[model samples]
Target chain A: MKLWEQNIRKVKPYVPGLQPKEDNIIKLNTNENPYPPAPGVERVMEQMKLDKLRLYPDYDSTELVNELAKEKRVDPEQIFIGVGSDDVLGMAFLTYFNSDKPVLFPDITYSFYDVWCELYKIPYERPMLDENFRIVKQDYYKENGGVVIANPNAPTSICESTEFIRDILEHNQDVVVIVDEAYVDFGGASSIDLLKEYDNLLVVQTFSKSRSLAGLRIGYAIGNKELIEALNIVKFSYNSYTMNTASIVLGAEAVRDKEYFQNTVNQIIEQREKTIQELDELGFTCLDSKANFVFATHKSVPAGKIYEELQKKKIYVRYFNKPRINNFLRITIGTEEEMNQLIIALGEIL
Target chain B: MKLWEQNIRKVKPYVPGLQPKEDNIIKLNTNENPYPPAPGVERVMEQMKLDKLRLYPDYDSTELVNELAKEKRVDPEQIFIGVGSDDVLGMAFLTYFNSDKPVLFPDITYSFYDVWCELYKIPYERPMLDENFRIVKQDYYKENGGVVIANPNAPTSICESTEFIRDILEHNQDVVVIVDEAYVDFGGASSIDLLKEYDNLLVVQTFSKSRSLAGLRIGYAIGNKELIEALNIVKFSYNSYTMNTASIVLGAEAVRDKEYFQNTVNQIIEQREKTIQELDELGFTCLDSKANFVFATHKSVPAGKIYEELQKKKIYVRYFNKPRINNFLRITIGTEEEMNQLIIALGEIL
Candidate 1:
């Protein structure tokens, strides 16, 4: 009965984590930063003159690209920015992937990856993880149009080292490989250095996790000049002004202020470790994580029960009701006080 | 040789008119606002109490939609905003136009439409414009999955009246029809009213032209419940954060200050008439325009000569080399002083 393209009808959208309506909840479902962005980020917004907005923003986000180039030691031409890492990944599917070639990703990674492939009408194959919830390198050696894997993988919060990624690139020579490092700043190794060794590797990173500009919606990819140029061409042919003025300038300032940026991320890292310890002592089997969150499930109690109980008490954590992982919960690391509240809630729930 | 989706290989992007590199040119190439955005716009940016850029923005832009609904006198569910009209149109093509049916638009209109069709691999038919450089609405009724037209048509600056659009919507009952009113602010009639009777009509408009938010990257579509919901589902599955915060706030202000917006657009209308008069006096034929820009050709001089010679005198105008309209140039109406400068430059060139 629908008048839309048939493919769009079949696309089941990526469901982002719960955004609570009642603001009183602890609200740790999404892995958002517990701290504000770098102080310079706000200054960029306030100090920005409004007159410039009357003109089109640089299609490439020039200043931010140059800053990313310097920080990542990649050429400015090799960097492409989008609304977020999701947008970048979406573009990758529409531009590089197709109905003919298979898009390859981890079976148990960020759910949005599969959603994007479906939206783009690209045939995709999910490589299953090992029994320990880790990506098996041998699985990705199969032929694919491109390979995408998240580093410091979401939900599990465990990292597949850049070494494994370099080896994947070494083998998948005919295809483009994307390494999403949304949580790299929390301690996972970034594959930024592998750009010279592999021309096909596009390392996707975001300001959302580390730089704390998630609201600003800035994500970038650094790759071989050709692949980057391809993304640029695709952007121009589609929507050129994907990034707004405030988002661009503010993102650059946040990415450049490593001291203030690292201070906030490092705080979250410290909190994550302490929370993992607390959860472990509570008889939860937790993953060794490098992200701003921890993934764990208790031996005797359903994690979903704890999550719902915390929600009743005005504390929130993420619970996936999907099969094979219904008992686990993903808890984002918040400020010291917030984490302490979460721990106290867990104690009370037990 | 390039390793990209085959459909993307032939997408030639629309080259936008040249932008001002320095401050001192009589710039009228792109049809930008002769006036700045509403006073509230700048104030919103200046006083944006965003001490929190670390958190993700409202991906749905809920507050913006709520404000837009109030301004437009429609339900919040009726409006779907995008990064710009480009993003909106691109999403529309992917959602409603792709598949077995051919997407249709005017051959001479928004070149990006064809590019997007190619990007989505959507079979398309660019129905030729009438000799008068206006869209022939009847052409769109011929077995298309969707049809889009720029209502105050670009380059030629002629608008199809509300009655004419209603006629198209009457016959094309099955296919989706999009009326892009990107330049409707000067004098064109909006097709928004037809949304009452037609679930198929999506009237797309932008802040870039009349509202002067080109740099902000914001635009939206007003439609009946079903079409808007379709776009929402497409946006959710693809790029979720379609509009940024500053653009959302500023766009709402632009829509709210109807008097200011009307007065500015009316001034551009007056200036456009005056420019047409002066050009007619100097032996050039100009089209009757409903939009803010003017389209004209001189019998004695080449359009390229006029364009290049004007640039030599620090005046700019758009010159399209497309075979159908190789003799004419599209000039945007600027402030009175800028128009005077343009007049003097044209006089010297003639």
Candidate 2:
């Protein structure tokens, strides 16, 4: 037996969306921003002093949290930053989901939630989404150790309203509720507005989608100071300097340029609407998406066949081979021209 | 009572070296490289396309691992990258040190070892070092689930020979033996040389000390393919994209420029020699240090007092308040002028 095999947890790792090996491909599989980061990002990259890199970064990510607090209109103590939203959410799971009662989440949301639960040995139950790919608010009224819901749920691309989330929070007052808004910038109403009313609410957002800084690995959580402290304690024990200097500096600049962020978000929303209309015309069933991607299935073609055909045409979209959603394709909105190419290629494939 | 307070692991998080808020201070607290990164690092930063920030980085650190394998004379399959060495070692503890038998480490080794054990809920025993502060190889003859030793052990600054490490490995064939070479570039013999003879040995090194990339957050482990696969399994399950793109791109550049890495290492070794001689003249008991820093105690002065006096002079050195090391201080070697200033300040304090 291998020495490492003794205690290693056997985990089926979450397979991220296909990142194309070849360039010049109309990539729409991962829900990444189709536009470049804010113009200030380039400026931050240029102005960063390579000399200061000899020392460690600020252990608390003080400046980034301060800037985010300013933009989000919260106390600096309410923010917890990590390498990415996955890191933030993973740490949150370890910190708050330790009760003997089973934690809860949507069965078909971002797949990483279940993986984290397994990694930490947290008992969790997946509540099924309705046939319309929407969360049933009534199902979450039962007792749970904790809860997490991806606003504008992944792959399905349907978001629950802030009031619906608040209703769930109202019932689950004793347990922490995590609202992952990874793709909320497109059109979904954020639960950050509910943070004031619900102390148990933890709202997580990322620069990966709306701010276009996925390569920089910046993500954060906004919650009550007590919850944020719990995260910081775990983070400090795990790794003191989680964020690199380049990311902290550049992420701050990305957030500071609100106009550029808004413009890019607007462009993606416009393209998503156009793509939804085009998909409907092509005789496909498309969900009313509030994210950077559209969830659709052709009336006649199998989703796998469409995915394979799109690969041959150098266009990529996400397709899960799991039950209930195996027939659907989650197509990330790309540039208008790129989406146009995708549409033309799909027309031929069909 | 707060909902999360009950489950929160009441961990006294490891306190990292002070990162002073003000500039222009002589920072010798953390054993960070005094020099800047390779010239190629700047070029890599400048040439990185801002548009690529929209997409996620390669989850596996493909290019970075490829370049590192070439430099380290190992196969790409033998390498595993992390956010930093702390992140690397923490994951290793979670991966391999889970047998019912307790893991073993040096009593006066890197302080994070115990913290990691606590974080992972691993049972560990710290066998005491000899009075000379050298690891007694015979002490490790007993059975253990795993073993980790920081060569040129932190706060002691003493290195064990590769033959000595091999003796321990020879007995512990059923378990993994980890040799952390974080400061090995300063002068010590790297256990990387023993990888050919021992498949059970996992050697970890960092760019933070010798390559001047602490703020970049890059570290890696070299082991047999099976052990590496175990680490990758946990990493992929934990966080797919740990290293940000800039660290991956520039860390490769830092490794490729071997001549620059050698030049900086030599300069630090020279400064270390000069500082050790000077401290000896000041009636200090300095260890036979082979690392970037020296562990010393004044014959009559308290280590805490010296640390405070150095801080008042705007200089910093690490001091632990624990037993056995309470009287000693770990002083990182700085530029010649900075070392001279530190010596002058010590002379006045004595």
Candidate 3:
């Protein structure tokens, strides 16, 4: 080892999905929105004062927070915005999970959970999901430092009901429960309303998938004022100006246009349902997905072979090599035309 | 304390300068550039493709990194970009400074250094600056896990020569030494050249000061390939897509216009020298500033009073109430007209 590397903390970094430079490929590995952001976003960007780049952005992210609060029907004090949902979730991990006991999360959830636990030296336990890839709430009843549930979990694309989440929260009233709702806007119910009942609950959502601003990187969390305050403390300590001016301004513009947001979300949901039925007809055992993606495994084909074959045709879908889910493929739902192409490609492959 | 607050790590957050929403104020508290970003930046903003935001930004910031590599005359492998210099420095602290020995920095330097140490649970020692507010190189010769020297250090507005930095690096060859050149573009010489001699040297810089893109939040570090890789490991593990799409494109455009950058930098340096002479004429003992700011203490007046008086008149400057430097005010260099108005205000106050 190099002399400087002897004592530093080191961990294997997470590999994000391929962001192909070429434009002709069907990109579905990462669950990014397939539509453009709200029309107001473009207008705001056009009218933005380039001169303002000389000054620092608002440290509080006042405009974005205000817009989110107004949209979610919560007071502005209950909201916290960051560069992306990953940033918000990372800050949450740093702030709330500090006890000696291990935090509890689902084994088959967003892979970042374990990576974060390791980074912060926070002990954690991953309770196994049921055979159907659903969260088992009773497993969280045991002691834990905190709880993180990625609602409509990644890779599985299965969402748990809020009532089930309520049960988990009730059983563990002392620990902070972070319900990451990155995919909730597609079809799953949001846990935002439960914030009124549980002071320990934090619901994290992102504009990347639903608002179509993945490249802009705006994510937020809604919770009780105290929870938000704790997050603010951590954020300020880490990087005070986490959100830049364009993101704060354009994100607020995107949030204010409710009709555009809802219209795009409905379109995505319709496309996702159609894609699932088509995959099912091709002899794929697909999960009951409430997210913007479908998780399916073919009845007679190895997922690795199918993934390689699809890649040759410039069609990309996420295929994890981990245990218990190696045979499944997670495909992001695109526009109707894109989905039609994806179906045709799958038909040829099968 | 609330139930969720038990045994969690907490630190007093760093307080940044005020970012007032009103447009009429002559904002000078934060050390921001007075001129706008390069004209190319405005063009990039105008021609921005709003459609691409639906996809994620390049995880590696490929284009920005390539641009920076060409501009800095360094290999792309030797660069690590971040949201701001704060993010770059924060990641450096997490990646290096892991041994049992305390990290070392100047006591009266940038306040965020101490906050980052506390946040990462790294032990650190602050060596007192000499009476002239210059770094004492001998003080850093003793054992340390790592060292951070802010060239043309903030609040003090004084710089240490690269020869002095070399002496410190010679004594401590095993640990990482970060030479933060945030204000190097104004008048101070950069330690970037020393990277050829020392494998452990890391030079950090930002676009916020000389480039006039504080609102865009772009910062970078240039080091040996190994150190850059170490920072990348930590950054990717923390947040893969830290740089948003706009920052990547606009920051690169800002870097590409060499003539514009040099012109603005020269203007700032000229204004800084004039501002120092004026402050000296006004019975203030101003430090020999090599930065875009002037640090001065009035011979007969208190800095706190001057700060408050300037605030009353809609002119803002930074005043820290810390020990040994309580009388000093760090005034950011503004345009010639703005500086003249500031001089008039100071004359009346004194």
Measured by DockQ, the strongest candidate is: 3
What is the per-residue lDDT of model 2 for residues A189-305, given as tens digits with 9 covering 90 to 100? 999989889888999999999999999999999999999998898888889988999999999888899999899999999999999999999989888899999999989999999
DockQ value for model 3: 0.81
Candidate with best lDDT: 3
Per-residue lDDT of candidate 1, residues B223-323 (tens digit): 87777888888899987665666666677776778888888888888988999999998888998899878889997999989989998888889999998
lDDT of the candidates, in the order given: 0.82, 0.90, 0.91
Residue B323 error, candidate 3, Å? 0.3
lDDT tens digits, residue span A297-322, model 1: 99998877887898889887888887
**Between which residue pairs do clashes occur in model 2?**
none
Ten residues in sequence with the least summed lDDT for candidate 2 chain A: A2-11
- Candidate 1 vs candidate 3: which has greater TM-score? 3
Q: Summarize candidate 3's per-residue lDDT along B175-286 as a digit string, tens digits.
A: 9999999999988989988999999999999999999999999999999999999899888888889999999999999989999999999999999888888988999988
Candidate 3 Cα deviation (angstroms), residue B335: 0.3
In model 1, the runs with Cα more than 4 Å from the true position are: A2-9, B2-10
Which of candidates 2 and 3 is the stronger one according to lDDT? 3
| Fraction of the true interface contacts (Cα pairs closer than 8 Å across chains) found in each model | 0.56, 0.71, 0.76
- Pick by DockQ: 1 or 2, better one: 2
Model 3 reaches an interface RMSD of 1.0
lDDT of 3 at A67: 89
Which of the predicted structures, 1 or 2, would earn the higher lDDT when compared with the native? 2
